[model samples]
Target: MPVVLSLNIASKTIPVDYTRTGVTGIDKRPVDGPLEVRPPGKKGSSGSGVAGDTIGDLTAHGGDYQAVYGYAREDLDYWQGELGLDLRNGQFGENLTTQGIDHTHARIGEQWRVGTATLEVSAARIPCRTFAEFLGQRGWVKRFTQVARPGAYFRVLEAGRFAPGDEITVLRRPDHDVTVELFFRALTTEAELLPRLLEAGDSVPPQVIELVHKRSVIELDS
Candidate 1:
């Protein structure tokens, strides 16, 4: 059964080498107490769905569509062995460090009932300069993209309170086979797969749909 192994929140901002803002809340730590989860408004105006969690980069980080970030403990363990580092919960800045959930294969729009909150898979976390800098690892972006287990970003469908160790129940899954890994590949390494993302319909980000349309037009012209 899938469960929230750790609920992480950034206690405070810390200085970072990347991003226009000199500070980042990427150093999330597991927190004990229940947290209110809801949509964080729109991008550039909101940060984090968890009430007390911090989002240092508002321009690209937070919104209703990206209310929460979930990374699997299984994937973390894989990286731990490869990197030879003690990768702790929240090390990757994921708000929910989950166990027994195959995030890579979770379909877009799959809904999970965690505690009282309902979360729907919305997008995949793309590696950025901040992520690379936080890890202090060279070529981290390319390396992470190559692995393509970018984790899943979820949108809060029903606001509610939840805490660590809560069991995650799959409420529903979209009928498409466009899994998180496939979506990440389409957006990154596999441009040829972009057209297939359409099968996911509105479950994926609107910008992606628009991009696919634009690509189609360009391809027809050429």
Candidate 2:
């Protein structure tokens, strides 16, 4: 059976914006309607989806931890209360809060359908210094990542809109054998992780695949 879940706009929220590059949409709230989606790419991107050539051009723009795509308003807690976490609600910052869905286990290249919108998991939760700053400590954000296993970021594969309490359901699963959580672990410290991801690069995110390729070359030469 599919993972039935729900997520509220946790205390954290981010937005998709054409202005400001820092972290688009923290103060920008999500509109109440169909959660929009679009093809992934710079062309279809509008805040959250791809770059350009998309639908309404409105979507959750930025959040480092998890991206709610496949389902909504069913699964929560494990990330919020004692079961979930206190990270995004107070740390990394996001646009919408999810009540359900384990951001960490949701693999890359996974396909999810929210209403008419479909999105593909594109990458893992990348821990950056900015996130650390948000949480107000050194390396604090990164540590929270492991503990929270923030959800995955997604690129819109189809166009649609989502609002609070919209019944969400998964239309498909991941396309690869390598899961996002596994990739995160491998990339974080597992020596074999990169190699495994490299060998399985066919299903990894494009940017990640390229990064591994470049690192592999350097490691080989060194």
Tens-digit lDDT track of model 1 for 44-65? 7999998898888898888887
List candidate 1 segments past 4 Å from native: none
**How high a TM-score does candidate 1 get?**
0.96
lDDT per prediction?
0.91, 0.47
Best by lDDT: 1
TM-score of candidate 2 versus the correct structure, residues matched by position: 0.64
Candidate 1 RMSD to the correct structure: 1.1
Cα error, residue 54 of model 2, in Å, equals: 16
Span of 10 residues, lowest total lDDT, candidate 2: 50-59
